[model samples]
Target: MTFSRGAVEEIAAALAASGLILRGGFSFGDDQVAPAGPSGAPAKSVLLVGQAGAAPWPHFQRWLGQQARDIANPLDTWSREVIGAVAQGRGARAVSPSDRPYLPFQQWAMRAEGLKPSPLGILMHPTYGLWHAYRGALLFEDEIPLPDAHVAIHLCDICVEKPCLKSCPVDAYSGQGFAHEACLGHVRGPRGEPCRSGGCLDRNACPFGTDYRYPPEVQAFHMAAFARL
Candidate 1:
């Protein structure tokens, strides 16, 4: 359940060299209490997170339309590599923070895992908005220490505008929860102003993390997924 900091850094370096970009939210504290949000399991001893992305939007765009069925190969590649390295000797599962059977992800991550939800949304960041998604989560037989836990947050309770809710052309999201069907219909078939005018206005409207924007083709592939739903 423990390893030297240098060992951790080595893993990070190896993954980075392999193409997976490291997101800085490492935690090494031993807070017996397991994380309850996301997948709601405190049984894990370590947490590792990495995102999948492509360098040029154009290359990504072609991948989406060409042989790459599930485009975003580069990011997915990073995700698989890092997760594989981390799970070198363990069993792992890839999970999305969407409609789940157990407790809501926000509650569990915040309450059990000691993970704090971003003010924007439980799993979403004001910067990444909804465009980005957690490619997959790696669960270890025991806890793994992280570099830091600066998941600094802002509370949405005081925000007057609540732009995330109102921004959705089809009103797919609300204080209650996300309406996937409503969102997908609009994005795939063009039912509302934002979906009709551009694409997913709710995600695009966010003003944070502009540098890590999702490519257009990736967006299109996502839209296709929505349509099938």
Candidate 2:
């Protein structure tokens, strides 16, 4: 069950064929214990799979809708089914950001890709702007070779405009800090329809990767999730 570098790429390519990118990955030996798996077995290494922009939205949204018709927690079910299948086929364990006693996904992402946070707290991707996300990750019981880590440019540092700070109607985000209560109140108020129906105007204002912005439907979907309804 040992996985070679070639096998890693093969699994990555297979997931890519389904529109999921093997965003970045890391490896650790037995000396470096990984988080416990669902059965409480320790993981040896991990592969990070993610999506940039709306690459998987169309397919994922449709699948999620169908699952919602038949399941209670469609989002969780969809992620597990989609990502778990890949992990299972590769003889690896699957875990998510939402898993109880959550794994340090942000740290993992930083180590894997050298990502930095933007003003809005979303990771500023060099290519995807504010339009990317880490969907899930695959955990392996056996050690796997990691690809070379990248040194990504922190785009937010160079941008003087910082439009993300100005775009929110309620001034929810800024260099100072996020006004979480104000943001939630605004989104739940009478004037919140625009933000409720679309996504965060501040997030949409990030000029790094405008072309990768999520479609209206995808935007609305995430906005609703943020609203917790």
Candidate 1: worst-modelled 10 consecutive residues by lDDT: 90-99
Residue-wise lDDT of candidate 1 within 23-47, one digit each (tens)?
Answer: 4433324565544432455445334
In the predicted model 2, the residue pairs found to clash are none
Show where candidate 2 strays beyond 4 Å: 29-33, 37-40, 68-73
Q: Positional deviation of 66 in candidate 1, in angstroms?
A: 10
lDDT of 2 by residue, 1-229 (tens): 7888789888877777656788788876558758865456787777888888788766676786665465655556666677888877576888888888888888889888989988888888998888888878987777777766877999999999989999888999866799988999899889998998888888878888988898888888777777874
Task: Supply the global lDDT for candidate 2.
Answer: 0.80
